[model samples]
Every structure is written in C-alpha cells, then in structure tokens.
Target: MDITNFVVSARNQALLYGDYNTYHKQLAKKLHNCRKRLNIVTRNRGKFSKKEPISAEKLSENHEYLHLQLLTAERAWAHAMRFKAVHSADTKGITGRTRSHIISRLDKGARAAETLVNVLSDASTSGASDTDILEARAYASMLRGATQFEKQSWEPCLRSYATARIIYTALSTSMRGDIFKDLLSETIDPSIRYAAYQSKVPRTLAIPTIARKAFPSSDSALVEQINKLAPDLLKKSDSDAQKGQVGAPNAPQTITWRSREVKIEDAAIALALASTDTATALLEEKLASSDVTLPREMAAAYDEVLIASQDAADATKHAIDELKEEGVSQNDPRIQSLQITRTAVNYQMISWRIGRNRVLSGEHDGALLDSAPTTTRKSKKDATSRKPKIEPTGRKISRLKDKVVLYDSTLQSIDSIKELPGVAADEGLLEQLEATAKYFRALKSLSIARSHSLTDQSPNAYVLTKHAFDECQQSAALFSKHGASSSDSSPRNIEIRQADIQFLHNLLKGELQRTRAIVQIDSQRQKAAETVPPHGGSPLVQRLFEYPEGGANLNHLVDFPPKMDVIPVKPLFFDVAWNYIDYPGKEPVAATTPEPEQKTKQQAQSQKKGWFGFGR
Candidate 1:
C-alpha cells in the first residue's frame, strides 16, 4: 500500500484508541527507518537510469509516492494536537478519565504519521536529489519527536508545516498527484492563525511570549484577544487576595474573572486620618519646644514655627471638612483633631494679632508726642493742672511717684533770680540789645538755658567793658527809683537781668510751639503750600520794617557810611601863644628893645587879622 493509504488507515486506528503513547513509540521507530532510506536515495539520485528504465510514467509514480508521504506527514499533525490537549489536561490535574481519553487519541495520530514518513523516505532515497531527501527526513524527524507536542512546543510544528506548505504550493500540477494536489489546494488548515491568536493568553500569569513575537504582524483577532485578556489579568492581580502580597506574577491565571470596584469614600477617610496624624505631631513638637526657655533669636524662630504649624493645622481642618462632605464620619479622630487644631490656630492668631496692634499703637503714640500740639504745656496753669496724677494702684504707680519726687528735687536746685549777681553798668543799650538777641538765638538753639553765661557763646564775654560799665549805671539808676516800690528786698539789678532772660525764654518757647503746630497741621493735611495773593503786603516787604541799624530805607541800612567824619580834630597851639605870638615872624626888625607900643600895635594887628582874616 502507498504511504498516503497507510497514513489514512493508521490515523483512523489512532482515533479509535484515543491515546497517543503506543502510537508515538511506533511512529518514532517508523520515522527513524524512513530517514535512513531517504539518505540512501539522495546519495544514489545522480546514478538513476534515464535512457532505458527511468521513463515519464515512473517519474509520475515517484511524484505520487512523495505526495502521499506529505499527506501522511500532514495527518501526523493530528497526533501533535491530541498530545497538546492531553499534556495540558494532565498538567492542570484534570481527572484521570478525561486525561486517558486525550492520550488515546494522541497515540493513534502519532503512529499514523510515523508509518507514512517511513514509506515516503524509502521511496525518495532510491533516486531523489539531496533536497528531496532532506525534506523527507525533516518531515519524519518532526513526527517522531512526540515530546515537542507533549511539552506544548509549537515552534517546531509551525516551522515544519510552513516548509511543507511552501513546497507543496511550488510543485506543478503534473508533478504532484491529483489527490495530494486537491488536499493542498482545497483544504485550509487554520492552525497557524489559531495558534497565533491563542498565544495572546489573556488570563495567563506569564506575559504572552507568542503575542509579543507576532505584534504588528499579528492578526487583528489576536490583538483583540490580548486587549480582552489584559484587563482581566490586571483586575485579578489587584484583588483583595493579593493584598500585602509580593513577587506575584503580573498576569492573571484566568481571563474570565472580573475586578471589584474601589471605594472612594474609604480612600478619602484614610487620607484624612493620615493628615490629622501629621498635624498632631507638628503641634506636639511645637508645645515641647515651647516648654523650654528661649533666647531672643530662638524665640523669633519659635514664633515662625508657631505660624507655620497653625497654617498646616488650618489646611488640615479644611481637608477634614471636605472629607466630611464626602460622607466620612465626623467623629473620627482625624475629624475631631481638625476642630481642635483649628481652635488652637485661631487662639494663636488672635493673640498675635492683638499684640501686634498694641505695639504699633504705642509707636504711633510716641510719634504723636513729637508732632502734635496736644502734648505741649500751653500755659503755666495748664502745665500745673495737666500734671499726671499720682494714684498709687500698684508697684508701677509707686515707682512713677518716686520718679516725680526726684524730678521735684531737681527743680528746687534752680536758684531764685534775686540770689544771682547783677551785671556791670558800662553795658550800652546796643550791647544789651545784641546780648538779648544772642540770648534768643542761643535759647532757640539750645532749647534749655538758665542764664547767659551758661550758653557756649555767652554774650557777656563779647560785650565791651565800657558797655558793661554803662549798663551798670543804667541798672543802678533804675534800682534806686524802683527799689522803694519793689516788694522783694533782693537786688533790683538782678531782677532786670532776670526779666531779659525770661523774655528770651518766652520767645523761644513761642517759636517752638509754632514749629510743633506746623508739623501737626502738616501731618494731618499733607498739602503743599498754596501760592496765595498777598492780602495787604507780602511777607518779604513786611520783614523789611524790622530792619536793624535804624536806616530810613532797606537799601540805606544795608549800606551805611564809615565813622571817620565824626572824629574831633586836635588844637595846634595854646591860648597864650595865640595872643602873644601875633605876627611873631613879622615883628619890627629889632631896634633894641623895640617899643612896647609897637609890639602891642603888631599884636592888635595880628589879633585883628586872626579875627577878620586880613594881615596888618
């Protein structure tokens, strides 16, 4: 019988047995013998008779035989399929009954292909080329290796099938027999595509090794299969069963299972709890550090820490509120601490806010003292009436009273004007006025002065002694007249000096008060000075009225003449010489004791000349 007939009959028998072990053993032995014969046929192909015996009819017969061998090899694929099923079932620990049925089918298919390969190899080795011989040997070797299918190895099966399909397609219709040609042309074996699709393995624990290999070249059906399987794998992996688990395979075992949905409320609650723990820890740290006595720098740092902690706590509170709105329990420790932290933060914020305001207010008050008229003692009565009262309430009040007493003691050290010495009399009116003016300038500059000598530039030192002598006289005269009316027996002259000093003091005080008023008004209404039309006369013109030196005009006062014109001239001769030495150079040329009458006449002439501006 032909190899094709043997393959068909053996395949039927193997199916009947429904087990592959016996079939596999017989197939392995038959395939080994076929391979040996095919090798011999290849070595003898060149020596085959072409002239006498090797006719077209014989070549056609040989082609039919090779075609039958291919058919048998194709039929052997059935055994591989059966073996795969049986192995899969066994590995999965399926019941023995099902496993036996699969094994029986696998054995029958293996034996059928084995017998066919042996027949084809024996026929080809007689005169076939090395290529045909190798093809036959490859087919037989593939069938005998039952372990490839048992191990679920699909690569060898795919390779062999591809080679066989290619060769069968390339052969001419005349070269291959009708039955083999019909099988190759009409029948479609979808095993390759199906295997590629199956390799996607949606729920498998291991990554789809076959799927990666196919990738873009893989059929759409395969890609769809992968997409369908991947979600199931991820879902299974992320299930509660895998919680706290490590090193688990990334893919799922079964693709059929669905994933459980995550509870958002639970997640939110957990987040809130974690945030509360952080806020509590921060607060505790703050409180612990606060317990220690802090240096100034550390105190500043602590304040910053407090502010930061409060902000964190406030944020936590806001988060907790959101959590509660999302249906988390308000009674949860995190939620409870949220309220506590908010309260603490509010307390801190309020305390700091008030303290800062107080400090700022104090600074404002101090500044107001310098700029506002309200702080000034307007009059003596006002100064006495507005004196800060002493109400001893606490130690602060007692300390203030003690300070007042010390201030009063210092005031007593200020001597009365009567006890001071009087100034000299020679001081002229101009000198007095200049001294008074200087005292006003000094008082304005110093802001405090008890007497003229107390000033750095005392006017008394600059005043001439003659001026002092004159002032002493004027003061004495004034005292002599006013002494009887004066109630105090102390010195009248000293009283005059005191009056001058007091005038300067009052002038400076007035100017100072004016300056303060300007400042206060300026602070309240910071408007620039408006240029207004002069109501009567301009201030510049008004100032000219107080021009010094008593000039008739502003220009004249600025340019006064020198004192040389007022100087008295010295007498050239005395009165006797003027009477006796008349015409002294022009006396009669000395006629010895010249007449007294002549001398008298000459003197009269000289006197007349001196009196009437004519010479005798």
Candidate 2:
C-alpha cells in the first residue's frame, strides 16, 4: 500500500465516524420529536398539524426520514378532515368509546415506532433494518386511522388499522395475537355493532348473560351483545350457579345491615302472603258449604285459619315498624300502603265471620231469590234441574252496587303503594329493593283486581288477571337479574314472592269461572222467585198493579250467592256485588263437602298439567 493512500484512508474513516455521531444525536432528538407529535395529535392538543418544524436538517437520512414520516401522518390527518364520513358524532357526540380506542391505538403505535427507531438509530448500529423501518411506518399509518376514527370516518379508520395489523404480523419475532390485539380491535366500530344489535337480538354476546335479563327494551340487545364480547370488559360470569357471595362482585361497597334487612322483609312478605292464602282457603271452604247448617268442625277449621291470618298480619306490622326505625318515614308510601291493606283485611274478615254466623243460625235465609211461599220452597237438587229463572231486582242490584264500593277501597289502598321508597344501602341492594317494591305493588294490584272482578256486574276477571301476569312476569325477570347473588340459582330471587303471584294468577282465572257460576245461580233463583207473589198484598191492589196477592216475608226475599257446588271458592268474601251496602254470604261454618267435581289422582294430575303446562 502507498503511504499517502494509507493516511487518506485513515482520515476518511475519521470523517465517517464524526458525521455518524452527529447523525446519531439528531436521530434521537427527532425520534423523540416523533413521539411528542404522537402525544399532541392523539390527545387532540391542536386543531392543525405542523405546530413546529423538525430540527437538524443536515442529519443523516435515518434521522431526517422518520421526521418526514411523522409529518406525513400529521398532514394525512389534517386532509382527512375534509370528508364528512367521520363527522356523524359532531351532533351526537365524539361517536363513542370506539373513537377513544382509536386514539389510544394510534398513540401506542406511535410509541412502538419510536421504540423501533431508537433501537435502529443507536450510534453502534450498522444501518436501519427493513423490518424496523416498516414497523415505524405502520405506526404512522395508525395515526391516520385514529384521526379518521375521531372524524367518524369508519371506513378509512378500518383500512388503516388493517394495514397496521398486517405490518405487525409480518414481524416474525414480534409478540403474539394478544399483544397486538388493540390494533385489530381498532378496525371495528362499536356504534355500528350497536346499530346492528337493534335489528337482531344476539344469542351469544361476550357480556354476562345474566345482565341481558335486566335489559329487554329495544336498546338493550346491542348492549348485551357488546358486554358478552367486550374484550376489555368484565369476564364472562360463572356458567353455572356458584356459592353465593356476601356482596355483588361488581359492586364497590360491601353489603350492610340495611340491605340484609330489606332482603329479609321482602322474603317475609312473600311468606305472609302464603299464610294468608291458606287461611283464606279454610275460611271460605267452611263458610261456603254451611249455607244453611252451622257445623262445629267447619267453624273450628275457620277459627284456625283466622288465627293464622292474624299472625301473618302481625308479622307484616313488625316488618313495617323495623323499617321505620331505619330512618324510613312513617308517612312513607311503602309502609303506609301496606298498612292500609292490613287494615282492610282485618275489618272485612271480621265482618265476614259475624255475617256467616248469622246465616248458619238461620237468622237469614240461604234462598237468594225473590221470596216464595214456605210451602213452595224447593230442594237445591230440584232447583238445579229448573231453567234459568232469577232476574236482577232493585234489591239485588243495590247489593251488587255496594260490593263495587268495597273493591274500590281495596284498589285505593294499592294505588297508595305506588312509587314507594326502597331500602337504604350503599351497595347495589337498593336496586334489589326497588324491584321488590314493584313486585309487591303488583301483588296489591292483583288482590284488589280480584275483588273488583267479583263485585263488577260486567265480566272483567280475565282482563284483570292478564294485568297481574304482566306485572309479575316483568318483576320476575328483574328479580332474577339485578343485585347479584352468590350463586346462579340462589334463593336471593325471593322465590316465594313469585310463588304467591303465580298462585294468585291461577286464582284469578278460577275466580272468573266462579263469578260465572254465581251469575248462573242468580239467574235460576230469579226465575224461581217470579213464580211466587208479593206478601200481604190487597187483592184489589194486586189485580190493579199486576202483583200477586200473597207470598213469603219480604225479609226472606233473597240470600247471598249460593256455595260453589264443587269446593267452595277459597276465602269467600262477604260483600254483595251491589252499591252503597254490602251483604256478606252470611253463612255459618259448614262440614267439608266432597267436591262435586272431584277427580281421581290421575285426573287431577292431568288437570294440573293442563292448567300449568306453560310453566313446563
């Protein structure tokens, strides 16, 4: 080698080292500049891009290139704003969380790019790798996509995100599916998914399926779908019932005494309803069959029933008092309304007991038609064979009209319970209590509606029953959903409440059938009574007025509706379906009568299935 050539080569090497160091310094500053731009852009710091120019223009292509690339992204974002596709949220809002995620993806992608540039821009680096350069480029593309997302330009956003994902996947040594999932996730828009959800219900969303029960409205379908599939959201809850926990998993606070008490009372109310129903059955059965005969066994059974009802009433009262001690107002509609129901039941039940005793003692007759001569009295068997005879007279009409008033009072008591206060709690128990209040409110409505149907001259029992079913079904759905339970099939659902509602629903149906029977019975008696004449009328006056000359006493002209031929309708009520005055069935206790329509065991099972097959 020539000596001059050797010295020149050494000098050239020195210049290369010197220039490379300068490049390294500028590369780091500019790469950092790139990240700052990312921060500013993703956060929406400025309306326009190019807030400042890149520094150290004379630096190597490695440093200057990335600076230019970043600028390119900024320009792309600015240009994309011209399109209206992404501006839909201009009126509604910044679209939704999708827009938020898009921005986050772009920010993260930019950071990834900065990292790549740092690794490749090291002073010791031989040169930048093609793969590293491409990754940085991919991040730039992601920035543009985020901008489009903010503008509501979903199509462009999706394309840009797709491009970024492909670029990341191309890196053989890169992290797997999960690490780059945000890039893939950015490609889809939640708003679009929501729109799709409204038209078609999704059977399998990523959301916890239990939550779906809470939302049945048109808007809920998409929300449910998103929750099921939402990668970032809470995980799919247990597939089956788990041990009940003390507090809802999602709740921020723990369950407290107030919440626990609320649960207990709600459960108690349901039990009381069951007890009340049992008593009602006994009281009605005894009073009904003994239309003309007071039997000790029957009275004794009714007495037991009355005692049970009183115990239930006492339990309810105790619950109300506890609620008051918990800061709930005495005037609170919830407790007050329940009190009204209790009072009405007490007054009406006592009156019914006294009235029934009068009939069994023979102080009042069971014959509920216009009075007939004592010699003309016919046996019930013979009467059933006769054609429809009884018709509504002024006295009968008056009786029915009064029964309507009694029903109205019960209805008013129920109305007062509406919009009542729920239990107090820091936790989600408030939501549970709210649902409970609604269910109880519905129960009261059914109770009143049943009474209303009995007193109503018009047939509306079926419609009233339908109203009850609606309330219960909706409440049941809510009860099953809100206020998390420890397990999937926990008793936290207050199954007894549902049981009472269902039982009441069945009774409503039976009540309608019973009402029809009463109408028929009245018809028969009216016709039979027409065959008799008025008591003690003058012959001259009777002839002139078309009245009969003689008949049975006026006081014995009619009786309450006859006992149901099968089993007496459970919990027989006292009021006549008349206005202004209520005349109870006024019958004494009666021995158990084998139901006329009693079926064998298999027959009973078949009938039960027929009535409740829908539940199965």
Candidate 3:
C-alpha cells in the first residue's frame, strides 16, 4: 500500500484547513470507521472490549486491518505533534513530565508502526509484497527516529533517520512521484542533519554523506533490498564523500577570484566547486566536438555547470547565514572571508548563466542577421541540389525577437554581477561587467532593428541599427582595455575574443550602411510618389506647386499648341480714355447733363433738412 501517500494526503487535508489536533480527531474518526468495518468495534452501552494486537493473519484476511493499524499509528503521531506545538512557546522550556508525555505518544506510534512492519514481514502468512514490507519498515523507522529525536538520543536518532532516508532515496529512483523526495527533503533530511550535528558529526560533511555513514549496515535484509533498488548508491556515496577529504586527488581546496585565492573551508562548497570544474571540462569537450550544435542543445549542455556553480553559491550563502545565526560579528575574520567567497561563487554562477544566454543568442552574440538562401544554384554545389528553404518574414521577425530576449537576459545577468559583495569595489571587474552589459545592449538593438527591417519600417530600422553600431564600438574599446588576462581562459564564462569582436564590428558596419541605403531608397520613393500629380492630364502650369516626377510628363506639356479663350480686361479704363481722346467716327455731343430745376431744389432742401429736420 502507498503508506506515504496515505499519510501525506491525510496530513495535508487536515493541516491545510486546521492543525495536528484536527488531524488527530480526523484519524480517530477514521480508526472508528475502520474498526466498525472489521466488525470488532464495541457496541453502545456494552462492556468495553479489550483491543487485540493486529496480526499477520488479520492483515491477510483483510487489508483494511493494515489500514486500521496505520491510522492508529498516525493518530498517535499527530497527537504528539499537537502537544509539542501547543507547548512550543513556554518561556521556561518543556518540563520533564511534558517531554515524557510527548515521547510516550511518539513511542505508541512507533510501536504500532513496528507491529505493522512485523505483520508485513511475515510474507508467507501476511500475503504482503516485498515493496509493502520495505515501505512499512521505512515508516516504522521514521516513527522510531522521531521518538529518539524527542528523547535527545542523537546517535540512535541519526541511525534510524538514516535508514529511513536511505530507503526513501532508493525507492524514489524507481517511483515516478515526488512523495519520497518531499519526505527526504522536508522531513528526513532536516532531522538527520540536526541529529548528526548533535551527535558531533562535522558540519563539513553533507547530509547524504552523513546518512550513508549512519545507515544500519548490520541490517542485512535492509542493505540487500536497498542495493537491489539502487545498485551503486552506497559505493557512489562513499566515493563522493572521499572526493573532498584532505589529500584526495583533484580536490578543490581553494578558489581564486581576481587573483586572490581563498581557502574552501566548507566541504559542501569545496565539493560543489570541484563538480563545477568537472562540468566545465565536460561542457568544453561537448561544445568542441559538436561544431554544428543547435543553440538550445548548446544551452542545455551548460545546465550542469550552472547547477554546480549555483550549488557552490548556495553553500556559501548558507555558511554565511549559519555564522550570523551563531552571533558571529560581521567584522570577524571568518565572516569577512566568507563574504568574499560568497561574492566569488555568485559571480561565477552569474558568469555561466550569462554564457548560456550568449549561446542561445546565436553566433557572434547575434550581431549578424542570418539570411536564408534565396537561390537554388551555387557554383560550389550541383545545380539540381535542393536549396535551403527561406523562412517567412514573420518567422524571421520571431527569431529576432527571441534573440532580443536572450540579449536582455544577458544584460540582466551582467547587472546582477555588479550587485555581488565586492564586485563594485573592483574597478577592473566593474568595467568589464559594464562593457559586457553594453555589448548585450548592442546585440539587443541589432535584433530589434532586424525585426523592424523585416516589418518594412526602414527609418526605425536605420536608427536602431546605427545605435547598435555605436554601442558595439564603445563596448569593443572597453573590452580591449579591461578584458581578463590570457591566463584566465576557460569555458566557464564568455570570453571576449578579438576575432568575434572584429567580425561583429565588420558586420555591424556593413549593416549600418545597408540600413542607411534602405532608408534613403524608401525616402526617395516617398518623395517621388508625392511629386506625382493626382490627374495625369494636368499641364505643368496647373501643377506648378508639385515637383515634376518622371520629367514632368512632357507629352502633356502646356496644353500643346495653346487653345483660344475669352480674356477679361478693364472696361472702365476704355470708357475713361474715350472721354479723354476724340474718336474719328464719333460725334462730339454735349458732355453736360440736362438737370430738372425741381430735382435741384429738392436736393438743396434735403441738404438743409439733414441737420435737424428743421432749420433754426
């Protein structure tokens, strides 16, 4: 049966909505239902029936009996957890009585689990599978570990927890779920670490190594079962633990950052750093052999190195946190050294992360646009050979957008490196990081420009392309001045190669010219379009405001041989000139007008009446 699943699901369902007390109540109700189903429950008002211990025969008869035993054990465990949580805030600490009470509850759970294990182990009578037996054993060991943990018996607690861890770790390999992993990470690992610490195990040893050492080797059956599940796990753990001890071959004893080497005091960091070195070598070998590797494949190859570096960084952070928790002052020599180590590991991690982005961004860090073949024939190949298919403009634009995103990520990673503890104080390193950021920014601009060009936005493309070119130049100069020394060549991070910079410089130079030409051609085309008359038949005189495109359409010039039409002149001028000069055929008649005396008198009277409508 899936014991872990059953227990975890019960805990989650109860604890998510309530707490352990609630879980205990729920388990009690479940136990009652199970007993009722088995027809062994006491009747109301009847004499109490003595509970009999669960046995293999009952489990064989009905699997519900196993369920009943599991619920009983889980109820007890929850009750203990609830009691412990309730008394956690006591100022004085847990009293001896309360501690004993808690341990009693845990012991009861352990006994019930042990009973289940015994029943399952009797395979001939219980009809239990090997896997079911092992699961029961692991669960029982977990409960026993909890009991010992509460009792402060560190060695026994470590041994019991290690057994559970080893079983769960083995089972997790064959199982396709995270239940075992969750138990290991969330429950068993922490308990084991604490118990090991209390048992005087050195903090330098990793939890897995500790668990392996404390695993009950005397239990032949357990060892055989775990071996069958994971054949090399025990041997591998031994080898891993040996890799970083003093005088071990290829052990990472120290790490160098900016020519300053610091000793690797923490075994976890040392192990992680050694793994990183191995991963870096492997990555280099893979990349070197696969000349035509895909971008994503190359990126995937970096994951191992990235993970190792991140582990080192995390280990460093954890060490620092542990020291701080112990009330070690910031000015302590150990604290100061750890801070430096933290910066170094974090920088290395970010460097590899940026390297992965660089790989994804494509050749020359995406400075050059990869043009698709548009021709079917080449001088070097057969004419009948199929040509590479050209991607659609939309697809090309999408690829450029992807490159832009990678460049943006690279820029962000470079920025993050600046925030590391001592990076900003290191002038040369800071310059290199800034230069790297500028380089990625240039690449991002180039990507954006290429996308714009694909979308027929010539002006925007030209502007962005020019900006990219300028940024690339500035970054190249800075890189040349502040680049890492030649002795530091490694595949762990991006190296600003002179050849790559030159190639990108040439490509961006040509791209700037190409984009400029495109812009000018587009502008000329627009100007020509604007100069074209709306009506083709309009004469030059009528279209004087418009520039003559296509040489003014000379065939429709000036209405050809000019057509006759009425023209307006000043008629009043002619009338005035006629009066000034004599005409040959016109008689000189009286120029004076004949006026009526009555009209003159009325005009004079009106002029007099204008003043007041009456004369005074």
Candidate 4:
C-alpha cells in the first residue's frame, strides 16, 4: 500500500469505467465544488504561500483528485473519437451516416476538453505544488468547460472552474496530503503563487469537511500522507506564510498563466509585460531609428502639380471681376467723349493755322477782294480833360477875407500886447496881458466859423474881445492906483503898457508852442518808453523840473499849477516872487529913507495951510 502507487491505481480505475460524457459531467460538477472550496480557502488564508508545505500539500491534493478525474475523461474521450471516426467512414445508409456524423461531432467536441485536461494533468504530475496543481486544474477545467459552454451553455463551466479553484486554495492551507505540495509546485501559475504568498488567514479551527465522503477511497490515503508530512510541512508553511505576509496581509489571490501567443502584435501589451528599464530603452531605440525629416515642400509641389490650370479665358474673367470691383469700364461713353474733346482741343490751334495758310495761298474764292477797306477812327478824349473851370464865388471870397481879418485882428492884439514896455517887470501886468491875449485867441478861433460863410459875424468873437477889454480895464485901474500910491522911485510903480502887451503876446504864443511841443514830445517819449519796464521812473519826470509849490516848470517859461487846491496862494506867489527876485543877471534897486525933522515940518505946514485957508 505505497501512497504513490495507490494514487496511480485509483486514478486508473476512475478512468477505466469513466463514461467520458457522464464522467466529465460528474467530474465537472465535483471540480466546480472543489474550485469553490479552494477559492474560499485562498481568500480566507490569503497570506499563505504556495511554497509553504501545508498550503502546497492541501492545494495539490485537491488538484490531484481533479486531475485524476480529468485524465479519465481524456482517455475515454480519445477512444470515443477513434471509434466515431472509423464508424463514420464505414457507414453507408443515411441513418447510419447521420448517427456516425453526430458521434464524430460529439467526439471532436469531447477531444478538445480532453486535450486541455491532459496538458493540465501533465503539469500537475510534474513538480507542481499545491497552488500549481490547483491553478493547472482550474485552467484545464476552464478550457474544457468553456468548450462545453460554447456548445451548450455557460452555467456548467462557470460552476466547475469556480469550485475547483476554491477547493484547491482551502486544501493548500489545511495540511491535507503529501502529494498536494508536489502537485502545487509542478502546476501552480507564478502569478497565483505570488498571490498565495501574500495572502492572510485567521488562526481558527478548520472548516467541517462536508464533501469528505465523496472521496472515500482517497480519504484514508490522504490522512496518512498528511500525518507523515504535516510536521515538516507545518513548520515550512508557517515560516513561508509569515514571510509572504510582510507587506500584504490581506492581498487578493490572482491567476497567472503562460499565454499561447509567443509574439504580441500590440506594442502596448508587450511593453506592459516588459521591465521598466527595458521598455524605456526600447522606446528610445525606436525613436533613434525613426526618420524625422518632413517632405513638406515636395508635398506642396505635388499638390500644386495635381491642381488644374486656369485657361486664358478664366484669367480674363478674373481680371474683369477685379476691374468691376474697382469701378472701371472697358467701354465708357464719358471716357470716349473726354478723349475726343481732348484730341480736338489739342489740334484746334494747328487747324486754325492751316486754315490761315490756305486763305493766304488764295486757294478759296474772291470774297477777300470784295471786302471793304477798314477805317481807323480817332479815340475820344477823357471826361476829366473836358471838365469846366470853376470861378471863385463872391460869398466864398468874402468869407476868406473875413477869415483873414479875424486872424489878423487876433494876431495883432496878441502882438500889440506883447510889445508893451514894462510888462515883463510888472507883477500884475502879465496877468492882465494874458487875459487880453487869451480873449483875442478865442476871437481868432471863432473867426474860422465866420469865414466859412455860415455866419456874417461871430458873437463869440465880440464877446471874447469885450471880456478881454473889461479885464484889461480892471487891471489898468489896479495898476494906476498902485502907481499913484507908490513913490516914483519904485520900478513896480512904472507903467509900461507896450511892454505889458508884448509880454502877454509872447506868453500866449509860448503857450500855444508849448502845447504843440508837449504833444510831439509825448509821442516821442511814448515810443521811447515802450521798451522800458512799466514800473520804472517815467521819462516825462526827467524832462521837467519840480517847482517849490509842487508844480512842474517847463524851461522856466510854463508853470503847471499845483494839483491840490488846499495849498495857499500866498506860498505859491512867494515861490514865484522869490524865483523872479533871485533870477540871474537882474539888478536889485536900493531903498531911500525919509528925514524925521523934514517929515515933521512938512506935516505941520500941511496942517497950517488947511486952517489958514478956512480963516481967509
């Protein structure tokens, strides 16, 4: 009763009586149950590793049972296919042919499942440990079920593969059998191995074995193998499991397989399988090998060459369109008219010369000889040259004479007064003379109106003269009284009527000259002052001297009166008298004193004469 030989014999017995169709169906159901159980175990003990003796042994045992059933199905399926193929060739009637064809088809379908199972079983027999056995069984079962599912439905395959994967996972951690470890190592996919290594499990009692009765013959063998292996298996399994659990205590289990495809068409999928550095290096190498130069200009030329050419008519049409947009016309009446008018105008002068030449050549009629002789008429005289001479009318002449008389009278009076003797020396005489001269000047001015012939006589002239005469008379009376009261020795008492009049005349003439000079001087001064700053001292101030009475004196001849009337006339008169008295080149007269005794005797005599004359 060696464990290995017993397993082999049980596997053979299962195959010998196995109805491929019936066994596959039953095995698929059992496998499905095992798959479910293993999946649950794998999930619960997710931290266990396929390398752990306990996990591997458990998983391998379940996979061994699964693979044994799968092998039996395979052997049965091969015999069925051989029989069906021969039967199909020998059959002749339609019914036999149909039955043979059906059997052949069924055999073909079954063989496909059997081939996958055989491949998986071989992997299981190799050093495939618990996880390996489980993964191989799952993969094979999935393929076989997939075929059946494709022919029939998906429920059978789905249930079988699911149960097989679960059962394998559970048995792997349970420390169930010795062969289980070997089976796992031989058949477990690398990805699932890694996943089992990272999984976790609770420290709890084992789950009740409800399906143990189903594997009655293998149970005793399984327990005995497990008893012998569990000591070493437990130690190794716990150690490996703990190591695998380091970073991922609850890591999910995954299935990994070698795909049938040796080369991948999609680079992305290939890159995914490659290491990071290798992938990066390959990408860079591809980039280096690629040609980056673009044929842009050549492409453009190719496109241009492919385009259809524009005909002459089309070009002309485009040009016409452009001209229309620019508001130009090929044939315009106004443009033609302008051209014709310009040409005619340009040649008109030349045409006229040609016509004149023809006429001179006498190529035309004798009309020139019949033309009348031209006459030259005298030019009329200008209207200004034919104007009448104007005579001086009497009224105008009389008015002229009157103007002359009035002017002469005013001048004569002013002259006569200025020439009087003693007027320059007399104090009051100059004032009186000025009055008279002023009156005469007024009279002369009035004469301008009388001389215009608008009036026969000027009342203003007579009134001015009479006023002067009255002022003269009053001045004369004052002079005579002062003269009679003063001694004959006093020069002021001397009456020089002629000198007084002469001084007045000079004064009046000087006044008129001074006024005119002022206007002219002001004009010149204004011009000169224009260039000077406004706030500077006036040029007029420099031109005149200031008098003691606060008035301005122009050359000692004209005196402008004080602006304020509040100033006393006595101070003004004293200033004028002082100026005159102190004048240069003038002699001062000496005063004579009277004798007291003689003055007393003269007074006594005057008194005696008055009394004696009354007595007589």
Mind giving the per-residue lDDT tens digits that candidate 4 earns over 396-487? 54543444454354345445444433234555645544544443343344334233323433343344334434444454454454442333
In candidate 4, position 210 carries an lDDT of 12
TM-score of each: 0.19, 0.20, 0.72, 0.15
Whole-model Cα lDDT per candidate? Answer: 0.38, 0.42, 0.81, 0.36
Off by over 4 Å in 4: 1-71, 80-147, 158-281, 285-616
Q: Give the higher-TM-score candidate: 1 or 3.
A: 3
Give the number of the best model, judged by TM-score. 3
Q: What is the lDDT of residue 315 in candidate 1?
A: 50
- TM-score, model 1 to reference: 0.19
Task: State the lDDT of candidate 1 residue by residue for 1-616, as single tens digits.
Answer: 2343345456557657665555655565565555454442324446754323223334345554344344434435655554555666454554456545544544454454454444433444445443343334333533533323433456644433333333332332224355344433333123332333334322111112222332332334323433442333212323221221212222122111012121212221223233333433443464356442222222232344345434544554555566575466967855554444443334333333322222222221111112112322267787787866553234433333333342232222112211212212223422432332333234223222211222322333223222333333443444444342222322111112444444434444554454445446654553322332233333334456554343233333322333344668777766546555547575435647758998788687677764466653
Q: How many backbone clashes does every candidate have?
A: 27, 31, 0, 57
Model 2 worst lDDT window (10 residues): 240-249
Better of 3 and 4 by lDDT: 3
Show model 1 residue runs off by greater than 4 Å. Answer: 1-5, 12-125, 129-138, 141-157, 175-188, 198-616
Candidate 3: stretches off by over 4 Å: 1-18, 37-65, 85-100, 115-134, 169-179, 218-237, 240-253, 263-275, 307-338, 372-400, 446-470, 484-492, 507-538, 541-616
